[model samples]
Target: MNYFITGGTGFIGTHLTSLLHKVHPKAKVYNLDIVKPGTPLPAVKDYKPALREGKEHAATFIYCDVRQPIELEKVNITPDDVIFNFAAVHRTPGHPDSEYFETNIRGAENVCAFAERHGIKKIVFTSSIAPYGAAEELKEETTLPMPNTPYGISKLVAEKIHQNWQASAEDRQLTILRPGVVFGKGENGNFTRLYWSIRGHRFMYPGRKDTIKACIYVKELVRFMLYRLEHHDSGVELYNCCYEPAYTIEQIVEAMKRVTGMNVNVPYMPGWLIMSAAGALGALGSPMGICPARVRKLQISTNICGKKLAASGYHFCYTFEEALADWYKDNNNQCLE
Candidate 1:
């Protein structure tokens, strides 16, 4: 078996690649992305590689942008290969509005086209909870998407493209996982930023204490993706990948303190004031690491459900607390300011 991945250098992609190497040791894995996973992760003690069919696998990283089908054209794709598409312009504060579409939407098109041309019918794509937008009500799989940003809209569009591609062929098996704020070791995004904030004694509640954030551990998400790929019963499937009973920011803060021993009695900062400040910063090109719009986003709840996946009988290995503990255990020495 051969595995092909787009955006293998990314945080989630990096973990996915490592886990795949352990589970399918002999299967040749090709990572088609513009960059490598960079510095090798310190090997975990007692790491167990997946031993299936008495074979092991290896992974090879290749520089290829998903926007150009020609870049994928040269790869020796075959019928037994599975494509995992994780490439997207997801950094909320860094990229332009157009960059999101050019990469996310167009990249989906190129990937779908390549798959159709090569009869590579199996695909697992990672989308985001951003598509559901900031809903006051809990969002389930049936929720009508109301994407607010270019990134969210592009992901919603990409989901449709994958759906259409699946509809065009009877043999296609597509799985679209709309994940929330994925966190774990090597996740240098929201969770890690929070770590530094707590360590620096700078963490403050942004308005309310009950602002819910949906999240998944990187390894747990990858494990589920691989499980679905191997034991899939065919047909298209969509699942929101996140912790159930989504934790509040306050809960996350407490978890950080418990896991990392970071002490911070973060005070509440009003939303309006933060928004106004963020707006001013946005106007000044957002010099501050925390943008005003993002400050506003922090106040909103990203409530989402993984009921569909849950009902499918796949048990998640990590809850919010367990996932936090896992990260702290892995990065025990790196939790400081």
Candidate 2:
């Protein structure tokens, strides 16, 4: 059976492609994304060709945007083909609020519609814990989504759009995974920034050390996704994809230090000072992930629960420290390059 991955050129998508190659060596995988294979995104410049070396030649690249009606009439898609929906504008404080809904929500609708037309039985959707809100509460699969940001709201709506498609057919299978902050080699997000900050001795606690950030290694997340896709139960199944006990800011920092052998003392910086510095930088701070919105995010805890994923019988391949170490090694002993 062939595999189709939307947003397949992205950080998580690229890692997923690599992992799929390891598992299914001769798999006919198609990467459908707006970004071409050779062109790496500016933010994720470290995304190297070596990551998809052997698999790159095998997988087909399709230039398709999910926001519009997916025009894949020429491509051969069968009922057994699996579709992974990873398309979305996920970055916070990066795009206009309307951009989130325009891309994420419309993308989901179009993807589900395409699935219906092709009679694709299996679909894997990568959602976010942002739907559960950014509060310090422990979010579970059953938690009522109270999305505060446009991205979260769009994701939530997108989840329902996929769910509606699933409900239309009894035999169709849907696996929705709401992942936390996923970090690994190609991730240019929070963890990468943290690594750089610590290595450069510019790391400082935003306000408190106890702020919990639900996170998972990219490889581990991909493994779980594959496991579910291979041995999925009938009908719709949802899970919060994160470590069982999420790590606090202090714990995460300590893990990074142990893995990278960098133990510069990190002092807690006052919230007011950070805001003042951000204000002084004007437009400069936004691009550096230091704006007011991102600063506020640093203070809030994304305490998402992962009991369902844990109970799925999929063992975590890497611990927090081990994951960090592997990421460091993968990036040639650098901050994931």
Report every candidate's CA lDDT.
Answer: 0.79, 0.84
Question: Would you list the clashing residue pairs of candidate 1?
Answer: 22-50, 23-50, 24-57, 25-56, 25-57, 26-56, 26-57, 27-57, 278-292
Q: Which stretches of candidate 1 lie over 4 Å from their true place?
A: 39-58, 71-75, 277-288
Put down candidate 2 lDDT per residue, 49-143, tens digits, no spaces: 32344435335789999999987856778898899999999888778899999999999999999899889989999999888887887888999
1-337 in candidate 1: lDDT tens per residue? Answer: 6788888766777788889888987877887777545533243222122212333223587888888883554566787789899999887856789999999999999999988888888999999998998776899999999999899999999999999999997878999999888887666678877877777766678789899988888888999998898778568888998877778999888987887776667888787776777778778876535677678678888898867777777788877777787777775645621
Q: Among these predicted structures, which one has the highest lDDT?
A: 2
Q: Give the TM-score of candidate 1.
A: 0.89
Q: What's the number of clashes in each of the models?
A: 9, 0
lDDT (0-100) at residue 195 of candidate 1? 79
- lDDT measured at residue 264 in model 2 versus the true structure, 0 to 100: 86
